[model samples]
Target: MQSNHKKRICIVTRSLSEGGADRVASLQSILLNNLGYQVFIVTILNSVSYPYKGELFNLGAIKEKNDTILGRFNRLLLLRKFLKSKKIDIVVDHRVRKKPFSEYIISALVYPKKTIYVVHNHAIDLYFPPFKWLTKLVYKKSKAIVSVSGKIQNLIFKKYGFRHLETIYNPVDLDYIDKQKIESVTIESPYVFWYGRFEDEQKNLSLLVDSYNDSKLKSQGVKLVLMGNGKDKDKILSKVGELGLTDTIVVLPFSSNPFPYIFNSKFTVLSSRFEGFPMTVLESLACGIPVVSVRYDNYEDGVLKHKHNGVLVENHNSGALAKGLNLLVGDEKLYLSCCENARKSIESFSMEAIALQWKNLIEK
Candidate 1:
């Protein structure tokens, strides 16, 4: 078989910030580049924070006065021209098609010929509200649909008839995580750690604050560490202050390497309302730390196997979520059991294994 190493590949996404998919795109670019392919990341907003091995193609540089109708049309048309001129082979896009007139939809218009759509969310309801028909149109034009989890794949096909879909779980760079974990770090206390954006809509971060504020863990001198940033950062910080947890709740900035934080934490906690497959849980487990997370489609299956690897909260409410956190952080026997199985449970999702799946998809 002739090798495709000399072939050019492009990954299109809005930016590498605020979410896990962007991180996945960055990791994929690095892995593909290492595999001898010429990889290029085409980010609309140049907001890249994650590490990659590819040359960046920032379309956000070519901007106008504002995002007017004419401005959008010009950007879309020019982007199409640029993609065509590059003669890229197999563009894999990891962005949600927002609307009929958005950049995502515009790319969907041009990418079907050479693009495989990677769906990151558990559902596409965030973007499709008034124009639900656009969902069908976006997928209809996709060469193939790659869901991050089997549950997400099933959810997509169940709503919209069967299509060319495949489930490729997110890749966790275990080597990078392990290397970072050993690099001496300092955390004053054995805190209950939670990271990712402060978005209450998806992550439901307020639940964490409420639960922590009311929990016996705080009275016992255990701290709650909140890291990462987003649009709702100020609001969340303010909520913590209002609840008089300004000292108990420690908020830190977003980090590229959070393994050290996860390594030293008592146990990780997730209060997400919904998720495709959270990277934090994967990374925490990879570091031999258990997680107490809200029950979701992906978390319960192979990772947090309900007291096997980590405890699963049956409800999304603050009380239920707090109880799960307390169980994992407070109980020594169960916490030790979860920690014993944590690293072993997520071995299949390692970057080495999952990268092969991506290689097959890209070559196909």
Candidate 2:
């Protein structure tokens, strides 16, 4: 049933395209809309790659037309007007608030009292200002600060001591994923998949290549598929070429629906140096495909239960990652076991479960 009074909500985000957090923001719009709330998505950038359900206010388009200082100010003014005109009861911000002054203007002038800031990374500095006082002031008028994981929440509390903090795991739309996973892809090889932005610094695609090269999967006729676009696409491609595994390692463009690829793969892998609850891992598991990831300290227990649903290897160790990858590929019994456990393991992160949490937050 819908809430007694249908509230209007505006999800503030960088873009509806790319990035895990942006995807979460898009999903929230869908969830809220389903719950009978009027949802408006306000994106700072014009990049719209992900699928969403809501009225979108693309402020970037206006900025692009003028591309002046006054245009930027006008965009802010227009944003405030949009919220006022829509009578937005709640503002869920999912953007990285790096600029303190800009955030100050936003929090103090534009956003409503019930605004909730989301911290999407272990690197809290990206979401919260470097200065504690500024960080507190920027979000002081807001209702709560939401971190995507428990570890991220603790880190924020420990560092900045923000009282109004909450942890909401990124939700996976299993229904949609299940539907998409059933769709056919042309690839015939039994390949392991890694899909996301090709940024080497954060994603550590170098580690992914090195580990894959060192693994036995290549010799066993299993190809490595790297999917998605980013700043380091050329660098990653060059690395793959240097290894002379281009034939075995295929690079594909970003797909709005990656579930089909995930569904067809042997298993998915994550070799990130750091992450804040990667959606790829959750989505793969939801697709009934097990994951192999180098252990990042902040990863939630339910996301990867080591031998239960996915393999979590030693942090930053390519050798350990390779072994973990090989372990799943070589041991047919264990791979099957992990695959069987994968979908059920992430039940807590389902849309219904996470949406309930959001509902309570919004209602209260």
Least well predicted 10-residue stretch by lDDT in candidate 1: 123-132
List ranges where model 2 is wrong by over 4 Å: 300-302
Best by lDDT: 2
**Estimated TM-score per prediction?**
0.92, 0.97
Report how far residue 135 has shifted in candidate 1, in Å: 4.2
Alpha carbon lDDT of residue 195, candidate 2?
93
Best by TM-score: 2
**Any residue pairs clashing in model 1, and if so which?**
none
User: In model 1, which regions exceed 4 Å deviation?
Assistant: 1-5, 63-68, 103-109, 127-138, 184-186
Q: Each candidate's lDDT (Cα)? A: 0.78, 0.88
Candidate 1's residue-wise lDDT over 1-364, tens digit each? 2245666888987787757888889888877887778787888775767888877877776553546778867877777776778777878888766555564456466663656878777755542324556567655665578888787788778777647888898888888888888765556776889999878888888888998886788888899999999988999999999999988899999887788999998889888878887888888999999888887545543367888888888755678887887787778899899889999999999777887887887777
Q: What is the per-residue lDDT of model 2 for residues 1-364, given as tens digits with 9 covering 90 to 100?
A: 4666688889999988778988999999988888788889999988888878889999978877986878888898999999999999999999998877777888888999899999888877888766688777667668999989888989988887779888888999988888778888867769999999988888999998999999998999999998898999999999999999998999999888888999999999999878898999999999899999887757663379888888989876679889998999998999999999999988888888888899988887
